[model samples]
Target chain A: MPYTDNTFFLYYNKSVLTETDVASLDGILSKCSAGKQFAYPMADGWYSSAFYFGKGLGFEVTYNDHLAETSIDCDFDNATGEAVTQAMWSYVKDSRFKADANDSKIAAGFNDGSIVAAVTGIWNRTTIQNYLGENFAAAKLPTYTLYKGTADEEQTQLVSFAGYKLMGVNNYSKNKTDAMDFAEFYCSRENQIKHFESRGFVPTDVEARADERVQADVCAKAITEQLKHSKTQKSVPSTLWIPLEGLGNAMITGAQSGSFDLKTQLKACVAAIEKTTN
Target chain B: MGKKRERIKPNVFKRLIFAFKDGSYATRLSFLVMGFGQIARGQLAKGFSYFLFQVLFALYMIFFGGRYVGHLFSGNLGSRLSGERWNESLQIFEKVSGDNSFLILLYGVVSLVLFCVFLTVWAMNVFGSYENDARLERGQELSTFRADLRSLINEKFYIPLLLPPFLGLLVFTVMPLIFMVLIAFTNYDYAHMPPGKLFDWVGFKNFQAMFSLADGAGFALVFLRVLVWTFVWAFFATFTNYFLGLVIAMLIHKKGIKLKALWRTLFVVAIAVPQFVTLLLMQKILDGDGILNKILSTNILWLADQRYFSLLPRTMIILVNIWIGVPYTLLMCSGILLNVPTDYYEAARIDGASAPQIFFKITLPYMMHITAPYLITQFVGNINNFNVIWLLTGGGPVDNVYYGGGSQAQSTDLLVTWLYRLTTDQNPKYNVASVIGIVIFVISAALSLITFNRASATKSEDAFQ
Candidate 1:
C-alpha cells in the first residue's frame, strides 16, 4: 500500500465521449445506456461494493476496507441510501447494462466493441489495450449526486477498493540474508522500472515514477487521479460479498420489473445484510 | 457331506496373556524392549531395526506425542490470544499467551493415531518373539534374515500389497470424515474463525439449534422447507427419469420400431456432450435475453421470476432434471429390458390377460425387480443433486424465506446447495453445515440400506427364473 496502487478506474473510448461528459455518473449512465455501448459488471459482488460505498451507507468506507467491515450497519433503507438507489433506478432498465457479473463477459463486451466504456482495474489493461488500441483512455471513477437540486450540483465522488501486491522474506528460510537482499533488489527502482518496461507494472518506488516512460503512461495518470477517491481494503469477512451483490443487483432487477417496490425491496436487502452480519 | 468347520478364535487379550506366560525370558524381554529374542537368535539386522523403532517411539511419547494425548480432554482449550507483559530486562513488551486450540486439536488427533500405531508395533513384537521361542523349543532351525525377507514376499504378500492403499484412505478420507463428525459438536461459525479465535465443544447445542423453532436465524424453519423440497425434488427427479426413460427405451427397443439407431444416436448425443455444457447452454437459451425468448417472441424471466411463491422455478428445475437424467436411464433400461425373457409375456397372453395387465404384471415388476438398486442410487443422487439447480437457476429468483422479513428461500434449492451456501456464504456456519451433512448422510444411507435389503430379500424368490 505504501508503494503500490490497485483500484478500479473508469476506462472509456476517446471516440465516444469527452473528459467533461465522463465526469459525473448521471452523464455516463444517461448518455451510454440510451443507445451507445457502455457496461459495468454490476452483478459481481466485488464491484457492487463501489455503489454501496458511493451511496454513503453505514460508515465511511476506508482504505483498509476489508478489515474495516465488522458487521452490517447498512443504511440502504435510509434516506441517503434510498436516494442513491433511486438515482440508480433510472439506469437499471438500460439494455447496455447486461445482467452479467463476470469480468470476462465485460472483457468480451469491450473486445466486440459493444461496450464503449467500463469500470475495472489495471488487471484488464492489456485486454482493453488490445481491443481499443489508441482510442483507449482511463480516468478516475465518475462522481454521483446525493441531492437533486438543493444546491446547483454538489457531486459526491464514487470510491473503489484499493489493494496491493507485496513481497516478503520468510524468517525460517535457510537463505534468509540472501532472501532479504533479493526482496530489496526486487523492489528497487531500477528493477521496478525494468518490470514496467516488460510487464507494464506501475512501480511503487518514487525514483521509478520519475522515469519518462511512466510519466507518459495513460493508465498510470488515471490510477494516480483515482487514488484520491480510493479506499484501502480491509480484511473483512467473506459473508458480506453475496448480500452486497444481491442488494445491488436486486435493485437493478426491481428497477426493470417495477413489480417489486424499491423501498420495501431495499429494506429486505438491508434486513438480510443485518441478519447475516449478526 | 463335509461339515463347515468353525475354528474357535482366541480373544485378543487372552492370546496376549498366553504369549506372555508361555514365552521365554528373552521373549518377555523383547515384549518390553523389542528385538531382544531376535538378537539372541542372531537375526542381528532385524533385531537392530526393531530396537530402533522402539527407541523412536519412546522418544516421540516423551517429547511431543504424550502432551497432545494428555490435552485432548484436559478442559483447557487454549484461547487464541497473545497476552503481553513488560519485560524489564529487554525494556520491551513480551508476548505470553501463545497457546492455540485449533492447532492443539489437530496435533492431538495425530498423536492419538501415532500412539495407536506404537501399541500395534508393541503387540507385533510380543507375537513375533513368542513365535521365535516356540520354534526354538521345537528344535527347528531359526530363519535367517534373508529367509524372513523372502517370506514377506510369499506368505505375507498381502501386507505390503494392501498397506499403501489402506494408509492413503485412512489418512485422506477417513481422517477428514472423522474431523467433520467432530466439527458437528463445535461452535465454529464465522464469528469464531480460527486461528483468530477459539471455539470449543458445545455438545448437542448445534443439533438443538437445528431443530429449535425459537432460534433467531430460522435455520430450523428454512431447513425444514429445504429438506421437504429435497425429498420432493428427489422423488420427481428419480421417478420421472425412470418412467419416461423406460417409455423411451421401450419405444426405441420396441419391436418394429424403425430408424432405431438414428433415434438412439440422437439421444446419445446428449450423453456425448457433457451435461454441464448442455445445462449452461440451456440456461442461456431459457433466460429472458436468451435465444429461446428471441425465437418464442416472448420475454420471460424464466429463471429469475417467482410470481407464485416459486411454483415456476420449482417446476422448471424438476422438468430440466428429467430431461438431463432420462437419457442415462433410457440407455440402462434398454440394456436390461432386452434381458427380460419373452416367456412371461407369452404365458400371460396364454392366460387371456389384457395387454395393459400383461405389461404391468410382467414387464413392470420384472424391470423393478432387476433395477431396484439402481433406482435407489438414482433417488439418492437426486437428493444431493447440486449441479442441476445450481447451473440452471442457481437456486434463484430469491424466495421470501431466505431473509428475516418473511422472504422466500430460493424455491429450487436442494438441501446440498443450501448446505453449501451455509458453509460458503460470507458468514459461514460450519457447525450447522456439518449437522446438515450428517443428516443428509443418514437419510441417503437409510434409504439405500432399506432398498438394498429388500432387493436381496426378494433375490431368492426366483420370480424371473
Candidate 2:
C-alpha cells in the first residue's frame, strides 16, 4: 500500500548525512546545524501522526464506504505518545531545522541548500535529485530512539500513511469480456516489470519485483523497505481532516507560545477529538 | 428623463377584474386556454399554438411534474438501498440501482419554477385577451400578429429583453443564495452531509451559539476578535491606499513632474501582473529563511511562525495590501483629481496661502466631496478582502490570541476570510459559516442602506452633479 506508486523515505545529501547518521532520527538531528540540516513537517497532522502511530500506540482507523463515515482512534496524549512526540518536538527550538506548518518552506529550504536531508514523499524525488545530483540517496525513514540526548532510551520507528491505486472492472460495461482481458493485460507481471523499468512504479505483482533492474534501482529499494512498516490507510472522510489538524496545530502552537503546558495541551487535544466524534 | 413607466405596466389585481368583466366569449375562452380570442377573431395559427401549450403543460403535469411536487413532501430519503439477488443457474447476482436524493431535489425545484412560469403565461393570456376585446368594443381596428411583433421592437422592448436575463439570475444566483441562507438554520455540519444523512431545521441554534459566550468553544469571542480586526484592517487598508495614492497621483500630476507617463507605468506595472503570484512571492520573501530574512540577518517570523510571538504577519499582510492597493487608488484618484478645477487651487494660492494650506483648503475638500461615495464602497471592499490575507499568510501563525472554535483562523483573519475557513476547511461547520455569511451580508446591507439614504437626503444638492 504505497501509492505515490512508492513510499516516502529519507532523502539526504550524501555530503552531510552519511549512511550511519541516516539510520536513526536522533543521530541525524544531533549532527545537523544552521543552513545544513533535516526538515520533517511535524506540525502537519498527516505527517506528525506518525509519532503516535509507532508500535507503542497502534493507531487504528476505519471507514464506512457506504455512508462516507470515518473513525480515527489515536491515543497520542498517552505516556508513549507524549514521549515519542516530545522527542520529535525536541528539534523545534533549534533554529537550523526551521520546523513549521508550511511544507513548501521545508522544500524551499532544501532547494536553497539550507537543508541537507528531509523526510518527504516521492512527489519531491525529482526536485531533491536535481538539487543533490550524484549526492542524492534515499532510505527508509530512520528508526528513532526516544530522547536520544536525555537519559530515556526508548526505541521507536516512524510509521506513515500508505495507499494503493486500485483498478477494477465495471459490472455493466458493454464489452465486459474485452474489458476483463485488457485489465489483466495491463496489470500482468510482465507489464508491471516494464512499468518499474520505465515509470519507476513499484509493481503490485510480486514477481515483477524480482526483476534485476527493479532490484538495482535505489528509489524502488528504499520504497520496498519503507512500505514494510506503513499503515494501510483507510479512505478517511475529509470532514475529520481540518479539525484534527487544528487540534494538533493548537497543541503545538500553545506549547511553543507558553500559553498551555504540555499536559494541558495533550488533554485538550483528546477532549477536542471526543467532542467532535460525539 | 428616466421616469418610471407606469403606463405600460398592467395593474396586478385590477387588470384581472376589468378583463373578466369586459371580456367577450372568445376572451373568456382565451383566459382558460391561451390564444383562443385571437383564433376566434380570425387568427387561427396563433390560436392553435396557444392551445398546444395548454395541452403540453397538462401532459407534463400528469406524466412528470406531479411526481416532483409529490417527492418534495415525501421522505426525500436519498437512495433506496441497492440489492443483489443470487441466481443459482447463472452462478452470479443481479444488481439493482439505488434512488438518488440529489435528483429528487433538483427536479422538485425545477418543476416548482416551471409551475410559476405557467401561472405567469396564464396571466399574460388573460391580459392579452381582455385588451383585444376592449379594442374591438371601441370600434378600433384589431392589430394583426405581425403588428404585435413589430410593437415589441418599439414599445414592448423591455419585456423580451429583460425576461430571459431576469429568469437566468433567479435560477442561478438567487436560488443558490436562498439555499445557503436557509442552511444557516440547519444542522448540516460534517456529521450531516446530505445524500448519506438527512438534516432537519434547527431554527436559530447556529446563530444563538455564535452570539453566545456561554459555550467553552468561544465562537462569539472569536467572532468579535476577527470582526474587530476586519474593521481595523479595512480602515487601515482603505485610508492608507486612498490618501497615499492621492498624494502620489498629485505628485505625478504636478507641473514640474517629468516623464509623467513613465512614472505612472512604473506604478501600474505592479497591478498588471496577476495578484496571486505577487502575494505568493511575497509569502516566500518574508519567510523565516527568505531573502528578506537573509538580507536583514534577523529571524523575523513574518507569518507569525508556528507561534504568535510576533504580530509581524498581520502587519506584513496589511503592508503588502497597501502596496498592491496603491496603484489602483492612484489610477482612480488621478481621474478624479483631473476634474478638480485649477481655479480653486489658484484662488487659494493667490491668497498668500502656502502649498500645504491650499491642499488642505481647496484640494482636500473638492476631492473628498467627489470621492465620498467611492470611500464607502472601498471600505466595504476592504471588509470583504479575502485574497491578501488568504494567499499571503492564510490568516496564520495560529495563536491562542484569536478565537478558534475548532477553526485554524489566526490574528489576521477577517470575518469573510474566517467564514471561508469555516465552510471550506476539512471539518466544515457549514451552519456557523452560513451564520457568518448572514452577518457579513447584514453589515454590507446596512452600510449600503445608510449610504443610499444619505445620498438621497442630499439629492436636492445637485449643484455638484
Candidate 3:
C-alpha cells in the first residue's frame, strides 16, 4: 500500500470563518489531532460541509482568490403575514410545479417532504432535526476522497466526496516510513473518534463511522446519508462559471423565457464543459 | 531590356521631390511640401517631428490598429481548432491553413472601393500643390496654416454643414458601430473569452449558423419573429402617438378648451420621466400580485404567463407609448398648428367648406410637410426604442427556446434586449450581438433614407395644396 501523508488539505468557505472561530478550532486541533497539519483553502463551495469542519477542526487555511463579501438578505424564519402570503402565492402560481389540495403550500403548514431532508452544518443539526422530526434519517458519507465529477459509468468502489481533506504522502520526505506510520495512526479509528467528537465530521475510519454515538448526532447522520448519494460538484473549469446556483438560475430563466432553446443550449453548455476541462 | 525600359520612365519620385523644392508647384502643394523639405533646408526640428509621426503611425499599425483591420478582413479563423475538422476531400484531420477564400473575395471588393477613394485624394493633393506653386511663382501670397484654421470656422462650408451630423455619427453611430463590427468575428462568449483566455477570429460561422437550418437555426427563427413584432410595434407606436398627440394638441389649442397650459403640462409629465424608470414602475404595477392585479383581483398574468404575455405587451406598449409619446408630438405640432394661415380657413368657410373638409384640404397637408423631417426622425426613433421593451417585461418573464434568450429569457425579447443579453449577460456573445446590431442599423437606415428622400423630393409637390 502507498504510504499516506498525515497532512489534510481542507477547503472552507470564507464567509463562515471568523477570527474567534479560527482560534477555537486551533485549540480543538491541539487537544485532538496533534502533530497533524491541516490546510484549509478558502473556496465558495466550502459553504456546505467544509466551513463547518474548518472552523471546528482548526485547519491551516490558505487561499488565492478573494471574493468580495456580499451580504445575502434571507427572510426564511420571519413567517410574517405578507411573507406567508408571498410564499403561498409563489407556490401556487409558479406554473412549473403542480400542487395537490393537501399540499403544504396550500395548507400553509410546516412542510415535511417539501424539503425531504437538507444536509446542514453541525450547528444546525439539532435545530433542523427538531424542526423535521422523524420524517428523515442520517447516515455516513461512504468515502473520504473528493473527486471532480462522476466517471462515464458508476463504480461502487469509487466513493465520492466533496471538499473533504485527506492525509496524503509527501513524496520528498526524508522519513518516509515514519510519515506513513504517523498518517495511519492519525486516521485510525481511535484518533478519528477524537477528531469527530471535537470537530464535527463523520470519522474517516470505517469502525468510527459506524459508532452509535456518531449515528445519533442528527447533522452528522444526515451528512452520512447524503454522502452515499454524493457526486462531486463538477470541477471542470466551465463549472467555475456555471456554478450550481447559476445552473439553477438558467433553469428558471429557461422556463420563464419560453423562446430560448434549452436542449441545444445545454448541449453547447456540455461542449463548453469539455473545452474548459481540456 | 530592363535598362532600356528604365530610360522611358520619368522617375516620378525624383521629379516630385524636385517639383516640391524648386518647381512652380510649391505654392499649390504647400500642405504636402512642409515637412521633409524643411529638414533638408536646415529646419531639422520640424522635419524630425514629421519623421517621428510617421514612425508612430507605423508602430500603431504593427501593434494595435492593424489587429482591428485584420479582424475585419479575415480574423485568421481558419487556424482555430474548430477549423481543423477533417475535410472530406483531404480525408485527414489537420490544422486548417491558408487565407479564407470567401474573405479574400470580400477584401477584393472593399479594396476596389477604397482604392478609388485613395486615388481621388492623391489627385487632389497633387493638383492643389501644383496650383499653389504656380501662384507662388507669380508672386501671389500663400495662405498660412492660421488662415486654413480660420477658414474652417468662417466658411460655413462642410464643417457647419456636417458638424452636427458628424458628431452624432461619431457618438451614437460610429463608435457603437465599430464596437459591434468588431464583435461579429471574435468568439466572445462564455467559453471563448478575452483577458482570461483569448478569443480569436471565427470567420462567418456566426452568420452561417444564423442563416442555416441547423441546431442554431432556431435562434434565427426567434430573431425573425421578434424582428417582425418589432416592426409592427414601431408602426403602431408611432401612428398611435402621432394621431393621439395631434388630436390632443388640436383640442387643447381650440378656443373653447380651458386651462390649455395646465392640460399640456399634465400630459408632459408622462414624457418628463426617463422611460426606463417609468417602464420599471409600470412593470411592477402590471405584475401578477402588483397594484393593478390586486385591485382587479384577476389572475391575468400579464407578465408571469407566456401565452398572453407575447400578444398583450405589444398592444399595451403602443397604448403606454401614446400616453408618454403624444405630448412631444403635441408640443411640436402646437407651434406648427398656430403657424397655419387662418385666412385659408376663413376663405374655405366662405367657400362653403366644412371643418373636416378644411382640415383635410388645408391643415393635414400643411402639418405633414412642415413636420416631415420630425415624422421621419420619430419613425426611426421608434424602430430603436429599447427602453420600453427592456423595462416593461425585461423582454421576459424569460424563455429558453428564444434565440436571444438562450435559456435565459424568452421570445418576447426584442432585438435590442437580445443584443443586451448577448453583450451584458453571463455569456457575452458579442459576435452575434454585433451582427444583430448591424442588421438593426441597416433596417433603420433604409427606413430613414426612404422617408428622408421622400420628404425632400415631395416638398415641392405641396401635398395639401
Using Cα atoms, each model's DockQ against the true complex is 0.12, 0.21, 0.03
Using TM-score as the measure, which candidate wins?
2
Q: Highest DockQ: give the candidate number.
A: 2
Assign candidate 2 its CAPRI class: incorrect
User: Which 10-residue window in model 3 chain B sums to the lowest lDDT?
Assistant: B399-408
Candidate 2 on B135-167: residue-level lDDT in tens?
A: 766768878778877888889999889989999
Better of 1 and 2 by DockQ: 2
Write candidate 3's Cα lDDT for A1-278 as tens digits.
21111111211212233223323223212222211222211112232223222112111212222211112211211223122222222322334222111112211211323232122234333343455455433332222211213342111211223435468756435565677778888877787778667655556566777788776865554455445444443332322232212222333333344343334434333332222111
Instruction: Name the 10 consecutive residues with the lowest summed lDDT in model 2 chain A.
Output: A269-278
For candidate 1, state the interface root-mean-square deviation in angstroms to 1 decimal. 6.4
In CAPRI terms, model 3 is classed as incorrect
Rank all candidate structures by their TM-score, best first, as comma-separated numbers: 2, 1, 3
lDDT of 1 by residue, B1-465 (tens): 122224785877886887787777888788778888788888798888889999998898889877766776775556556456876875544455566666776777777777777788877877887777777777788888899889889999999999999889878887677778877877777666665566777889878767765546445676677788889889999999899989888889877989998998798677777889988988888876578776987656677665554666678777887778888888998898898888877888798999789778888888887888888888888899899988998877664434332212355677788678778765677888888899999998899889878777876645653
RMSD of 2: 5.2
lDDT at A10, model 1: 81
Instruction: Tell me the tens digit of each residue's lDDT in model 2 across A1-278.
Output: 22235346678888787888888877787678876777776556667666666654644456564343455555767787677656655555555555653556656766778788788776677767777889888888887768666777766778776766656777656665577678778787787787666666777676677778878877878888888878657644343344345445544444445353556545545544433221
> Model 3, range B197-297, lDDT digits (tens) per residue?
34556778777655554563324666677787777877788877877788888888988888999998887888788876777888878764368866986
**Fnat by candidate, in order:** 0.08, 0.08, 0.00
Give the number of colliding residue pairs in candidate 3.
37
